[model samples]
Target: MHNDALCNFWTSTLGERPPARPRLTAHLQADVAIVGAGFTGLWTAYYLKRLSPALNIVVLEAERVGHGASGRNGGWVVGNLAGLERHIGGLSLDERRLCCGVVADNVDELGGVLAREGIDADFHKGGAIYAAARYRDQVAIQRGYLQHLHDLGHRETDCCWLDAGQLAEKARFRDGYGGIYHRQVATVNPARLVTGLAECAERLGVTIHEHSRAEILERRKVSTGEGSVEAPTIVCATEGYADGFHDFKRHVLPVQSLVVATEPLSESVWQEIGMAERPAFSDASRLINYGHRTADGRIVFGARGSYRLGARSKADQAIGEAAMRMRRDLLVDLLPALEGVRITHGWGGSLGLSRNFRPHAILDRRHGLATAGGYAGEGVAASHLFGRTLADMILERDTELARMPWAFADASHRQLIKRWEIEPLRWLAAQAITFSYAGEEALMRRGKPLPLIKPALQRMNDYFASVIE
Candidate 1:
């Protein structure tokens, strides 16, 4: 079941198989080289050239462009981490503001680049929805985060609230207590955006090598099985598929997240079932379920299909029929009457998640080789944010963008594990959570009071959608 599920989703809903990339075949030298051509790699190269056009830059890809999460994602580009509102107490107002500002600008930065480059990845800057699937979920969100929004003074025309009944009528909105509208957020055709960026980068004289995977990193050089690349600086942007390093296993968890796409809805159907509010929605559950309506009317959806609490997670891994069932059932709860809706595309990809919920770019600064991974599922906007900043850091010995947060400061280290141990444990823990969260969501639908731990955990699975998912 797991194998079948993985094959279908990765190969189908995710779109075309990437063209074969030529492996690195000879030694090369450049001022800067980027590993992984997803958003981070492309953005890093773009920004580097933007800063200094004379500098030589190269970007290498393991598969066809955007084959990673950037291509596989549901096209929701966001700036903030899920559950960040709940952690603001420890941060000062100014610190909090800085964090919020970075996120707020995340989309705007993408928009500016997209427009300037004239790349039409179907960019839509309208806004997105952060929905509450249950009454209890609504209560928690309103009582807590509404104040956070007000405190930040971050309200924009595109950001606000909507009640449950209002949620029911959203385009494809089946049911929910209420939803939060996040202005400044947008959705795009991820593959288009990725390809467009690759083109833009190339037009700017940035050379890109597709099907080129880097397998080794020395003090200031990277050696792919096919060739070696020596550069003044190198950045690793591989998300969940970043196992090509010694330090990756410990520093990041490659989570397998599943996504499915419905056939494009008829125009009449879209008008009748969709919401005027256009943001994506995620529920409060230990296991979160999220989805968004594309510009073309197909619903792209995903959630915590991967869990590696004490084990390893891999992108090629399958999500299994049981996980799919849980997701389908949960989707039914969110949109009760849509049982017959056919899911035309199903697949999952892995994201490299750091223990912390932030994207990072790690550098062996003195040595000139840097590695960045671990978006923790918040990749879309965060990837650009990190990529740009990392570019600045490498281009100029230091960046004005304050030093990386402590959580992302660790030198990359490989995980300590025997093959037989961690993977099974991770699978077991995920299964247990899946069972418990499903039962809890069902109980909530019946108006039964949530158990003590349930409400606190409503957004648990939201760990999906993060950069690594």
Candidate 2:
């Protein structure tokens, strides 16, 4: 087995690693076959067993459980979806409210599941603070975001603007220029959550085969190197780790994201940092920086990552020293109290970004296929919601989750999802977007009066966001 400690801080918290599960060595038959035993697969297996105990289900993973983004994420259980407007932008206000409420309530639902399963994953729901820290221009950017959230159907109680004082009371960012206080966000140890969920699904009679990479996938069968499983329904939950295994990678490509955890801070340092509620926090940067106070008194932080050429997925856990240093610098910039803190762990993993930017749960009954993913880095909570939705759709249950805008039952993914552009085009577009965003951040940091350049660059970025996101 791979060294879990070297993977990330979260797996190191698991103490000694559990015994490895047996890989698939013989053909088997089941009612459903799930690919990739990550959050989406495990959650779907758990829900399917709960809703129908008689159904025989099997899950196959390329590595150990939570080997992908499920085990390596920054652990933010955001209530909102990435690129949510794409899904419900044209819906009525009441319809949009229903969808938003479903997502917002998912955070609490996940917490409840953890409690019921007796999983001590350090689940906390102190909310999140999207602060406009650093330069003065960020305040306008954040305010515009809060307005956009409201326009997208978030309730005032669910997401409210915090003045500078209120923001400081929540999180002591350097400038703390007032931002949005979203009440529905929470954090968890993603590694623990995924491992515990896998065990829970096993207890419910879901067979899982670790180190069983699906080399071939057909309408009713998924084959690993030595064995295959034939089922009435097949689920491809590989997400960002698809790695050209199937056409899923074409619709949902992998983007690399890295994270680092600081050593446990002193009480005095905590006091200076001011996250008494342990709310997740992030500055207003398109580069997408976010972090939270861990239960062990450390700050677990990460930022937006990049896409690799050919859409390759990250295989190793270790990140480069320069990348770790960059994240450390960003963390210290957000909270100057951590100027000399030690960064004990750094790791990178791939996350899925769909062509449409929004997430989906699709079940094609005619093809005996079901899949749920493209979370765009919000898969921690989005996976649970979509997993449950997939279970409902597969079971043909007439439920609200199955009727949501993101759920599709009658169409194949190839028909509903657009394929990504070919190699150099995809790579070039990603590079252009990254460079443009970095340029905008550079201008923000200058804090000067280049009115024409700043606004023009901002407008260009807005166009880019509209097109890509």
Candidate 3:
């Protein structure tokens, strides 16, 4: 099957689009040349034009807009930070608070933009719930939630812990002991959001060229097969597709995440699930998981999936049937009432995993380069801030967004995920780690002691701890 068919449920419902914008056929000069047409690139262009209308901006896209993770994501516009204090470890409480505030504001800011721009992406800021179904998850989430507040020096009102009764008001997850509720998260049809942003950018006079793949990007040039773009400033916004370019292949590793969507459910089904407001939900597991209620009344869930051998992020539409079944089983475990629901769609996309695991937006005026990515599947809301901050930095403004931790962070740090090992060993290690996680999660589900994988889990935990420290 064509990936375009499996890429997104949001796009599948949009009928057919008008033909894509013309490909670049002649060398062009612009004040800014962006290399990707996804959220990061479009958001940056939108802000730059809004900041200075006369600035010439051109966006080159290897594929159509939102063809990557931006469109294929679980549609949760959340405020969760990709890497908390670990990404900015030495920062004081004041600095951490500022970062958290920016993230929270980003969600609201995106809503405002959608309203003012006359774009309807089915956005609903109903918030999210983190379920702790198992006893182990319950204890872990409690500690993590308290530490989260403590780390930010935030009061209890910022985020509230819900008892089982309170959690019942939010969701009806099976075996749910407790949960955390934050009122800032939102859900949107991401494909509509990205495509709408592209249209808005065009209306604002930013030129977009699809199918213009940049084979070579230099100090003041981006050479594509069809044409070239010459500009003093260039931005690389190609997130998970960064490996396609020589300059970025080594710095970013693309890891795949898979998602499945069920057929539209009846109103009674939703009432039984208690997700009337459609708040995004996920459990407390190291292997990441997330889900949201779609606008069409379907439940879409996703999680970390089988990594490719050697971490290669190519177009592999075959996301093993076993992996898909496991994810479906997990969804049922969370909400047992959905056991009989039919799964209508299944797909996968890659997220850029940076060397240091931090979502970075850096402006190197000396090199005439500015880039932002490695979002680790949290880019929906973060990309908006990243784009605005990168624009501010390029404009030499001393705005609060520009001064945020990730805005100007160092990108040279090395971490375990970033270290490139030889093929078979790297592949083997990934398999072993994933197997251990599954075994551990199964044990936790059974209410059995996690002794079998405790040592392995501890070693893994210790390695990440050492890196953060």
Index of the highest-lDDT prediction = 2
> Which regions of candidate 3 deviate over 4 angstroms?
135-137, 153-155, 316-320, 409-425, 450-459, 462-469
Q: Which ten residues in a row have the lowest lDDT in candidate 2?
A: 1-10
Candidate 1 displacement at residue 287 in angstroms: 1.5
* Alpha-carbon runs more than 4 Å astray in model 1: 1-21, 82-91, 134-138, 148-159, 164-172, 308-329, 397-436, 450-469
**lDDT, candidate 2, at 221:** 96
lDDT score, candidate 1: 0.66
What is the Å distance of residue 200 in model 3 from its true position?
Answer: 0.3
For candidate 3, lDDT tens digit of each residue in 200-235?
999999999998888997887898998999998899
Give all candidates' CA lDDT scores.
0.66, 0.91, 0.79
Error of 2 at 432 (Å): 1.1
Which candidate leads in TM-score?
Answer: 2
Candidate 2 or 1, higher TM-score: 2
Q: Order the candidate numbers by lDDT, best to worst.
A: 2, 3, 1
